[model samples]
Each structure stands twice: as structure tokens, then as C-alpha cells.
Target chain A: MRRLRLVIPAALALAAALALPAGAPAPAEARVGGRPPPFVLPAAAGGPTSAPFRMGDHLGQRPVAILFWATWCQPCQQELPFYESLYQRYREQGLRVVAISMDSQATIMRAGPNARRLNVTFDVVTDVDTRVTTQLNPRRAAPFSIWVDRAGRIVREQEGFSPAEQNAVAQGIAELVGR
Target chain B: MDLRRERRGAPRRRLAAPALLALVVLGASAARAQSDLSFELPGVGRTTFSLTSTTTLRYRGENYDANRFDDDFGSLYQRFDVALQADELRAEARIDLFVPHTVLVESRCVGRPLGVDDPSCYLDWDLRPERLTLRWEPSEWVVEAGDTQLVLGRGVALAFRKVDLLAVDNALRGGHVRYQGSNFRFGAHGGLANPQNIDPIDLRIVREPQDVVVGGNMAVVAPAPLGVTLGVHALRVGFEDVDSIDGVTRSRFTDRAVDVAGWSAEAAGLADGQLALYFEANGLRRTQRLVDQARSETGRGVYASAQLQLTELTILVEWKDYTNFLVAPETTEANARRIYSAAPPVEYDGPQRLRGIGNQRGGAIRMDYAFLPGPWSFSVNSALYAFNEEPHRDPFEGVLVSHSWMTLAKRQEYGGDLNWSLDLQGGARFETLLHDHDARFRSGDIDRWMIHGRLDITVGSGDHAFDFIVDHRHEREIRGDVAEFQIGGASVTYTFGIPFTLTLSLRWTDYQPGVVVSRGRREYNFLGGEFYPSLEVRWTFEPGTYLSLFAGQTPGGQLCSGGVCRDVPTFEGFQLTFVGRL
Candidate 1:
């Protein structure tokens, strides 16, 4: 009986809260066919040693692939070598890859070592504060990928990694690079 | 009979009205296709608002054999998160609601004086605004007020943040400011520790202590030629002493204070990014104020690591030492909270509850070599730990432990028609207790071995995939009981394209140290020849949204994430989980 009294009021409050944002205009996010938000973060490994990474500098210069990963995520660990292979294959054809680590302060110290151990040679940066992640991968999914064309527009996005998606991801990159 | 009639009649009517109203409101909102809202404010800037919600509905049809609670009960847990960003300003808030609140049967009510029917065991209903924060960042400066996450100097001094995997989110409710430059960085923060009191999964409410904290850090980087950086940090915390008397909470301010001061130095990008080095050391002072006297104790810690990366080989070595050093230890079981500071544990990321951190020394080394051709790699690691012999103060004193593991992995694709991968790993752990505490006590040495393997095979260009996993552990503990145990599990997952996945898993265990046998009493028993089986189905509605259903039983144990560990309760029920953005 006491539980029922509490549920009724709580349910009504939730309904009211849910309806408050219904009338507002639709907003844009970092998704396919849109321009991704810019970011700057500390470089944990690779690319211009001891320097911070700014996304604007490489936006329109060449085709780019952005990979979001973490040290504790097993899937991320499995998927990194694949991205490393992709970077190695397309580096000479005006392709650039940036791997952003979403490891917090507790585990951020291992990001560099993990990236090194995985044989990743691309630019790796750390989002210790998660400010960039909030704007890009709001759901905090690991092994997320975003492909951008030379014109700085996002062409494709994937939430999780599977061995089956390797060819598709490679094909997307090949198209951007005009292979 | 009259009381029962009133309870069933009035509450049912009240519940139905709001439920109907909610459905109507939700239906009206669902007509829109967008999940986020955006608009421009005059004289201000472009503003955007987004909401994310996760709801879980659970029904327990069967209870554990020794549990006192009856089955056939339902519960709901929901979280609503809202964020707004306008140019350089941002605001965020979150609200959590639970109906007919539930507590962890194993942890909270198994052998305690409270029962499920007791109000002290579970709240009838709960709703709380868990987080609220505002921030402004312009150019090279950031100012945040309300709730904040802060860390200093490799987290040995002070660090507090949200660790979702462990269901631990503790923030500081005050203010913070920082400035970043090309070669210099500075920051400072001060606030009262605001640990989340509600367990999202169990919907249990716990009391939190109000600890006051203040900290700061500064760093300067040398030019390109030097490639070196130096920094310093300091932190102080006043942990309030809290006690419960006759169901009421009380606190004393003049109890204890902890202070840590530290410095760090790092050399990175040396030898053209091939070599990197880091070192940090801290000194701690803890002062206790008694009714008649005040006493103080001193401790210190050091952590260092070195890394070498080359085209085909990578090596990393780490070392850490501490003596009587722990920040804001859980003084009592009732007020269990995450420690304010977390140092790196130089062991494998599993089962850290038994690894002592207050007084210990350890080092680990790992090497990875890509010696084979075409998408194959091998790696090996070894670690050793030793603890001081403090017979009067420590329980697991003079203990020595060692761990070693090796893994081989491969990933291959054949003509874009098929893809496959394999990962095989095996490890062994040994522990020796030097001193004998007593024959009746369960204090002894341990020998354990484990092996894990995973295989993933995908066919037909991202259309279908299958995953198989197997894990086995064998252990022998030489204690008064002299127990020998084994645990094994296997699972298979089938994914149908990009929308759905099905997984079937089974686990068997013969290791039993904490299983209860009698209802309403703490009777010891062994769980021999027990099996737990479960099935799950997941569907993806869109990017950043999903629905999942799970049924059957789960065998829970120690789960570690982000350097924190917690015990999860076993479940025998059906669950539906939904995550959506709007």
C-alpha cells in the first residue's frame, strides 16, 4: 500500500519531465553526413611528441578515421590492431587516423603502454576529462568508429566492432581515399 | 480485513490514474523523430539540449535456496539524464527513480538483523536528483561549479570520478578552475565529497559521510630539446566520523585528518618517441584527535614506470611501493565508499580485493613481440608482490605472491568472404603466507591456475557472426579447511547482422566459501555440482539505443573495473533493459 502511494506521484512527475522537451526544435549530433565537433586533447602516444592534438589542423587536409577506445574494454583491445593495419595500408595515400582514448584518470596511465603493445602507430590522444567524448560519443561506447571524407563531412559511423565489418570499414576508407 | 481492503483499493486507483496520464504524455512525445532539441538565444548563443534514459524492469520468480524473501515480485529502476550546452557554457542534471525499492539480498539482508519486510532493509520508493553541474570554458580557461571530477599527479595524491563499470560515481560539490597554455598548466579544486548513496542496479540507499577536501596541482613542460616535464601537487581531507545510534546518523568533526603532498617528473618523446619514463612520490601524514590526546602517523609511496616502443617490439616495466599509506580507508562497513585516492595496482585487473594496498611493494614487466608473419602476435608478463610483517596490525602480513601469463592472438581475413580471430591465454598464481596465525583460522597459502580462450568467426561480409568463449580456473587453498575448487564457464553468441544478437551461456562451480544454507540463519555449506545457465537477446533500434532481455540464473562474484572492485549478487529472474536517447 505504501509502495503504491509513492509510485503514483513518481510516475506523474516522470511523465511531466518527459513531455517538457517535446516542443523544442531538433538538434544536430556527431553522426553520419554531418560535420563532427572539433576537439583538442593531450597526446598520449604517436603524432608530434609532447604536443596537444587539435582536430581543426587535419580536418580538411586529408581523409581521416577517428577511433574511440579505452584500456579496460576488451573489444577495443581486439579492434585496435585492425585499425593499425588500416592506417599502415593507407598512410601513403593521404590517409590519417586518430585514436582517442577515453580512459579516465585511474587507468589513463596504461593507455600509452596498451597502444604500444597493440602495435598502433597512428596518433593516439587521451580524453582524460571526457569533454570531447561528451560531444562525439555521448553513449560512451567502446570501439566506435567515424570516417570523414576529405571535405570534412562524416561519411560513416559504427558503434561496435565485429570481424565481419573489417571489409566494409576498409571499403569506406578506400572510397574516401579515392582508391 | 478493513486495513487490507483499504490498502488494495485506494492505492490501485491512485496508481492507475497517473499510469494512464504517463502513457498519453509519452505517446504524444513519441511522434517526433528527433532525440535532441536545439535553439538560439538572442544576445547569448546557440543552445542545445539532449536527454538519455535507461530503464530496467525485473521480475523474480524464483529465489535462492537460503534467501528468506518470497518470489513473484517486480521492480523498476530508471535514470533520466539531461544536458544543455550553449557556446562556452554547459549545464547537466540527472534524476533516478525506483519503484518498490529493492536491496541486495546477499549483501544487505542475508545474515543481518533486518529482513525484507523491514522498512530499514528497503525503501518503499525512491527518487533523487543525483547530479547537477554548470561549467564555462572559453579559450584557455575553464571554470566549473557545482559537481566536478578531479585528479592530481597519477592519482596517488587525490582522484575522484565516475567509474560506470563499478557503478561508482563520486563527485565533489564545490568549484574548480584551470588554465592551460602551450608549456604550462595549473589547476585547483576544493569541495565536500559527494558520493552517490544509491546503488543503481540494486536500488539500495546507503548513507554517505560528508568529507571536506582541498587540492591543487601545477606543471611545466620543457622545450623540445629537453622533452621533460616537472610537476607538484598537494591534497588534504577531513574525513568526518559518522555513527548510527538507534537508526539515526551522527557525525563528529574532530576525528581525523589526512594530508598528502607529492611531486612528479616525466621524460617523454625521448629518442623520437621510442622511450618514455615517469616517476611520482608522495608523503602522507595522518592526524587523529582523541578526547584526551592527539596522535599522528607518517607514510609514503612511490610509483614509476618505463616504456620502450619500436616497430616490432614493445616493453613496459612498472614499480610501486607503499608503507602504511591509504587515503580515507573505509572506517566501517556501514559507510563503505570509494577511496579518495587510488594508486595503480601492478597486478592483473582481476580479483583485487585480496591484494593489499595499505602496505605493500610490487613490480611488473611485460613484453610484446610481433615475431610471426601476417596478423599474429605474442605477449608475456610477470609480477611479484611482497608485504611487510606487521603481526599486530595486519592480517595478511609477510605474504609473498607471484603471477605470470602469456597470450597468443591472431586476426585474419580471407578474400573478403570470411574473417576469423583467436585468442589463447594461460596463467598461474602462487601465494605463500610466512607466519601461522593459528590452526583454527582460515589463513593459508594459495595455488591457482587459469586458462581462457576466445574464437570469433564471421562469414558473408558483416551479415552473420559467431563467438565462442571458454574459461577454467583450478585452485587449492591450504588452510584449516584445505579446500580444492574448480570453476568453469563457456558461452556462445550468434549475431544476426546489425540488429540482433543471441547468447547462451552456462557456468559450473564447486568452490564454496560463502554460501548460505539455512533461511534466516548463517549456516555454512558447500556448493558442489552447481550449475547456472542463462540466455540473452539484444536488439538495436538505432545508434545509441538498444533493448535487451535476459532470463534464467547468474552466478555472481567479484567484479573489478577502473581499479575498484565490488561483489555482485546472484540473480534468478527475468529482466528487460532499455536504453534510449531523446
Candidate 2:
């Protein structure tokens, strides 16, 4: 009887989620295939800069990869070099990679400047005061990434970084870039 | 106003609306519309909604007493939450339904229960909707209603809080409004402090009045370059739920009202971006009615804090004290002024069980150092508690009815905490934290030292997460003897690929002390023990949707969001849950 009680509602919900049409209206959060929000910020010193780091600027022109990282995160330190290499390899595919840092504008004077010293040459934008990450992922877990297609739809995202995730991340980039 | 007279019909009425809402959510979420509002609604902004259903089944016996076991199945808890923000308009609402079991079965929730109040131990069921709020903001101005948490500077003087245990969301059913500019901020709010006893309460026989609280806060920030700010806050409260434990209920408020006001000032940029300081002082005036006699008195409190962060090191210091009626939320206090039993009451000078942070003077200092700015860090903290009085009284200088109240005696404490994480090959990492606090307290010059220590270790990477904690306290609260208590807990989780995750957890505790006879509870704590173990499995079929199954014996637990905590009941059962966005 208890099993039945548990099964009934769960079965109903399962049927509901499965029976619904493929094109139902959903919220624009990543949890359900919603388009990612757009942002524009200034590029901090000591990073690659081509455009002004505007997400919408790449909407129709190219696929975009947004990496929300912080200088204080060790995983970010480990993964940034890989992102630099990905950018160097994909720049020809019109792939725009935005590395947003969760650091104060001035703290960059101390905690920053080391990325370039480490040979990481990628577009790094500073989200001082946490305006963008608060709207994106309030948890602010670093090494977070969001993959968007040329149409501005977010195709993939993940929090935390490790070498094992590189393959999965590569797969996400390949999907959005139509590689 | 006889609650017993209304029991039969009240539960039905209370359960109907939330149940209906749940049905609507369940139906709406079943739609296959795959596009979030982003596609269909366009500029309406983003909205998030989730529907969840949980069913529990279990058996309880053995270790309960001699030989007694009861098989029970109940508390089919269902929840629906909807939140949305479309530009300036934002709103959220959550609906919950549960078996009102254990309403009549008396349980001890006084300090900490082995498990929270279990529905399987009760005989009632109820459902309700909460956190219903709708707001409109078009630049500089904001307004909302329904339920909300109220917090003030460091929350020492006052705060509106909710504990996650038993999903207890205590919010005033009211509205608040605020306006802000570059240099000034102001807000005012008013609502039902305690909107009658919602679900989980046997309201049918529990008659209580409504508590209404109204208040406003304003702050003036120094201009762009000044780095200083000042503010004032005030509140007038009308409590209607003050009832005695036996028979007739009496009001605790003076004419059922209390008024409070305070001032706050802050200055930052003390050392470029490394140092900052703030201070706030509160004055509380309350009129209490004891039988036919009413008395009013005023009390004052002060709070000051400083923070300094340079490179990988940070330092924080805080001090606070209140000497009369307090403006703080009762749950925010480390020590509660009132006992936490089924029917908690206030004690004036002596307490059998006391936990509260009010009517006391103390300060704590904390320092942190990050090793090369990595996951490894160390910190130290020291606090001093030298109360102004031995036997304390309210501003009116009267006994609480006839009960006495006393806080922890003059005490000094120091502790150190260290956290280190190791990077492993293939992204598998390990982390551990260890901390210990040693304290010496002198109450009537009978000084003694107590030591408390805790250790937490975790090792996992990618698809697996595991952590366990061991904690114990050794001290003598009573003079005759000193006995050591032990506590331990552990959890390990493994996620298979992206769709499934399994976890196991265990908890055991035996910490009994001869509490001061005048302080309360001389009996050993037999509520929790090593007999509890739990297992859970979760399957994420899609984004924002998860179906999980859990089975175990939970003694009693804590559920906290932010810094506030509420207790959860113990349960011996299997539960299946589904949470998905519809």
C-alpha cells in the first residue's frame, strides 16, 4: 500500500513530463533548455580583447562560450590554460570565449596580472561587485561555463573544473560550433 | 475563540486551498511544452517552477522503551513552488501538504530532538501554502506582500528567520516597501507576525491570536567619496499569540504591543579596501501585562563589528548586548531566552534549560589566513562573555511570572580551525577540516574548562562525493561529576553518469550531562543514538527534474538556510520523492 501510494503520484508526474509535447513553453533558466541571458562587460587588463566582451555582440556572428571564474579558485587556475588553448584553436571558427572574473576591479592590480605572466592569453572580463554572476549563478561556484550557439541559445553548462571534464567540455564546444 | 470547537472543520478548510493549488501545478507542469518562457513569453523575463511529491513509509520500535515497535505509513508530503521575475515584477509562492501526524502525541523538542517531530508518531494531517509574495519595482521603489524574511545589520538586534527543518517557514503574512538611491536607503514593512498556527499544528484545539509587526528602516550613505553611512530603524509590534501553557491563555505583551527603535552608523575604506567598521544601537520599549497589572520599560543594546582583509588574511570582530526587551528574532540567538519544549516559556532569573543571546554582553574575534590563496586555509577565533548581572531580569525588573532566567556565566573561549584540500590525479580531490574550542567559565567563581572539537573529512572527485564528521564535547556543567559525550556522522554519495546518484549516511550520539537542577533537564539525553542510518538514490531524468528515493532512520536533524536553523523530526522510513519543473 505504501509503495502504491508512492508510485501513484510519481507515475502521474512521469507520464506528465513524458506526454507533454516537445515544444512546450518553459522558463529561460538553464535547468530546462532555455536561452541563456546576455551580458556585456569591459575587458580587464592583461587578457585577450577583440570586441568589448558583449555577449549579444556574438549572438548572430558566432558561437560564444562564457566562463565565469574567479582569481581565488584553484580549479580556475588549472583550467584557464586549457581555455586559452581552446580559444587559440577555435578563433578561426568565429568562436568567442569570454572569461569573466569574479574579482574587484582594483584587486586585479594584485591577484590578477599573473594570468598573462602564466601565458594565458584569452579575453578576461572582470565582473566587479558581482553584477553578472549574481544574475547568472548566484552560488558563484567558480570555473562555471555556459556554451551558447550563434543563435544565442545556451547548449551546455557546468560548475567546477577538473581534467576529467575537459572531454565533456570539448564535446559541448563541438556541438555549439557544429564541429 | 475555542480552538477545540473548531478542530473538526478547520483542518478541512486549511487543506483544501493548498491541495487545489498543488493539483493545478501538477496539471500545468505535465505539459510537454519544452520551451521556457524565454521562447513563448519572450520579454516577460524568466520564471521557475517545480513540483515535488514525497511519500514516506517506515517502522519504529526497539530502543524506544523495553520492547515496543510501531509500524506506520504517513506524511505524503507534496510541494509546489513557483517563482518568477519579469523585469521590475517578481513573485514566488510555495505550497506544501503533509500528514498532520503526531499532533496529539507529545514529543520533546525542547533543546534538540533525536529526530524532529515525526508525522508517523502523530494522528493528524494538513496542507498549506506559504511564501506567497508579489512585488512591483520600477526603479528606486519596491513593494511586496505575503511572506518575507526580515534582517537587520548583522541580525543582532532583530531578524526575520526560517528554519529548513520540517520545512518550517516562519514569515509574517504582510507587506514591505523600500526605496533606494546612490546615497540613501529606506524601507517600511508590516504584517502578521504569527498568522495563526498553520499546518503541523493541531489548530483545531489550539486557539491563539494573530501577531502583527510593523517597522521601518532608513539609511543615509555618505556621498560617493566619503565612505561613511548612518541610519535609523524602528518597529511597533502587536502580539496576539501570547498564551499560557495550562488552561486559560494570558497575553505577554503590554496591551499586546511592543515598540522598538534604533540607530546605526558605518564607515568603510579604513585602510584602502582592507578595513571597515560598523556600529548600531537599539532601544526597546515594551508594555507587559501580568494578570491585571501592566508595566512598561525600556532597554538599550549596542552592536559593533569590524572587518579587515589584506591579501590572504582576514580578521573580523563583533560585539553586542541587549538589556531589556530585545528586537532580535528568538531563533537568531545562540542561546534561546525561552525553552524549546512543546510549550516553551520565558524564565526570569533561573533557568532549567537556557539558550539565548539577549540581555548579555560579549564579543568575538576571528582571524583567517589562506595558504597561498588555495583550498587550504586556517583560522582562529576567541570570544569573551562577561555578563553584567548574575540573575537577570527584564527592564521592568520583574520575574517572568515566577520563573527565573540566567545566561551562561562569565566565560572565555579560544579556538582554531584549519581546512586543507589535496589535489589528486584524474581530478579526484580530498579535503578535511578540523577545529576545536576550549573554554573556561566562572559562575560564582567556580571556574572550569570545557573543550569541544570537530573534524570533517571528504574525498571524492567527479561522480562521487563523500564526507564524514566527528564531533564531541567534554565539560562539566554540574559540579559533582564530569562526563564526556560523543557524537559522529558520516555521508558518502556516488553519482553514476548524469542520471543517477546514490548516497548513504549515518549518525550516532550519546551526550548526556547532569544539567544544573536550576538550569533544567537533569535526565540523560536518550533521544538520539547510533541506531540511525539512511540511504538515498536520485535520478535526474532531465534538467530541473529529479526523482529520488531514500530510506533510513533519522534521529533528529537540523535544516538551515543562511545562518538560521530549525529542527527536523526523527523518522524511520522509506521515502520516494520527485522534483521537476513543470
Identify the leading candidate in terms of DockQ.
1
What TM-score would every model get versus the actual structure? 0.81, 0.64
- Local lDDT at B58 for model 1: 73
lDDT of 2 by residue, B461-527 (tens): 4433343444343433332244433344556555443455677877654432221121123123233
Tens-place lDDT per residue, model 1, B269-339, is 88888888889999989887667587788788788888786766778788888766777633222222547
Task: Point out the worst 10-residue segment of candidate 2 chain A by lDDT.
Answer: A104-113
Q: Which ten residues in a row have the lowest lDDT in candidate 2 chain B?
A: B405-414
- The stretch of ten residues in a row with the least summed lDDT in candidate 1 chain B is B516-525
Residues A103-172 of candidate 1: C-alpha lDDT, one tens digit per residue:
8754565677567656677888987656566545555678887777786655555577655445555666
lDDT of 2 by residue, A132-165 (tens): 5544543355777766777655544555554433
